[model samples]
Target: MMFTISVPKPGLVRFSHDRTRCLQKFDRTNSVWSMKMEPKFSHNRKIEELSVELPAQPHPPHLESSRDRALQFNRGQPSDKDLDPDDVFEFGGYVAREAMCDEEYWTAAFLRAETHWEDRNRDRYVESHLRKYTDQEFNEIKKRRNVQFGNKCRCIVAMKKDSKDVKRPVLKSMVGTLDLRTRHLVGGETFPEERVKPSNFGSFRMTRSNRYGYIANLCVSKPARRQGVATNMLHFAIKQAKLDELERVYVHVERKNKTAQDLYKKMGFQMIERATPQLEEKQLYLLCLEI
Candidate 1:
């Protein structure tokens, strides 16, 4: 004899064999369905059983936060009400936003290290006769440096929009970053051209009365270079400076970096001072923009 089983509804099953029928209720405790049947014409008995297991459902995707959506879709200039300390700007498929959490700080530190890895190597060789620290030690130092520097400045990071991949983290999409901080000029005047030291090339003595915005460590990942990521970041940083009520914004660039100089010039930056002949090897130039 052949038995047929059918499920008319959840938690219920029907079985039939040659004019004999039986209804079986699924046992939730054991997650199984069992049916027992007795034939009318024979003293022999037969039982048919089958085990059923339901597959586990997957968890739902994470929902994007309102701030994250704003950062991805907001294109127009931000209004005064939108100018928070952690303002975010989006342009074309990229976003420039203030780095807030530890992860973001770490990512920004990594970017800085990548951009100046060659310099680090050269410095190590020059200072320690090529003695090198292990990767773990170097990373730990970078983390400590990030915390120290982050306490003194605001960090802005540029990244591609990952709306399509909400599962991807921010660090994976980061493309560029820059640092903005308030600086004070000694005696409320710019440093003399000949006296500007490499150690304090664009930096001045700290004073509340002569506060100005300083931009430093503007760099884009190699694959994301020449794609306006740096430009957008600069604009965002300048906007932040304006929001902070800074009267002037300054950036120091190597004199040999014509590309950077040209980019800054296009953004209304004017060279205010050049390094002295004694410091020509450093090739640093101070550029300023009046806000």
Candidate 2:
């Protein structure tokens, strides 16, 4: 059930201003995307080039898209192309590219924290700290995560349809969740010292260099399991990275979570050797894939 796909060498990829833009422009005739970069200081367009053969996993079975809806995403989110209301589509259950509304967005945060706790504390954590977050706390988190302030960070949430004594579907629960981290860019300029680089979790840097997106805060509600929600979210995050012209991708998972590790491996990620650190960081496993 594993397969490989050829993509433009990592060099050809460039992050577009729009997230939904084509990941890499492909020459359908050759099905290849290529890019060559000159020296860092070179004005001439001559440099090294490479064609990358990358491992690709298929989209999830339950993942679906709707083209009829107009383009609507979290405002202030970065994207390469302007979404035309005439031609817009969304994937998974009520996926929000960037949820801007404070209520919904905070709900997503609680969704993540609760999912992480996973009833391990029997609702104690949710009732105490995660139930509500102040604006200052949110801003601080965005800063630490390298997410742009005032810019909505990339995210996707699968919603469950619900109704009270009626058949009409009213969205009830935020079941599945995933968060994405792209390199911080503002006004066509790279943010000061805030690149999404390697070496997360225990300071175990990769032995080699890679420009990739960071994936975090993935969860599926207990009732929503096995319905392809997680797979869809992964596809969204990785696709976002590719469109941003990244060379590779990485995520850290808990060592106790074998199911998640297996899923990432199936998607072509390899286990990375991590640097030694405190026991808390040691409990995490880092997995990565070359786009």
- The reply for model 1, stretches above 4 Å from the true place, is 1-86, 118-151, 191-209, 273-281
Clashes counted in candidate 2 amount to 10
lDDT of 1 by residue, 94-135 (tens): 779875443455556556555544344446453233212222
Off by over 4 Å in 2: 1-96, 120-126, 132-152, 160-173, 183-210, 274-281
Per-residue CA lDDT of model 2 for 193-251, tens digit only, reads 22232232121211112334666667666666666767666776676666656677767
What is the alpha-carbon lDDT of model 2 when measured against the actual structure?
A: 0.43
State each model's CA lDDT, in order. Answer: 0.53, 0.43
Judging by TM-score against the true structure, name the best candidate: 1
Candidate maximizing lDDT: 1
Clashing residue pairs in candidate 1 (N, C-alpha, C atoms within 3 angstroms): none
RMSD of each: 29.9, 15.0
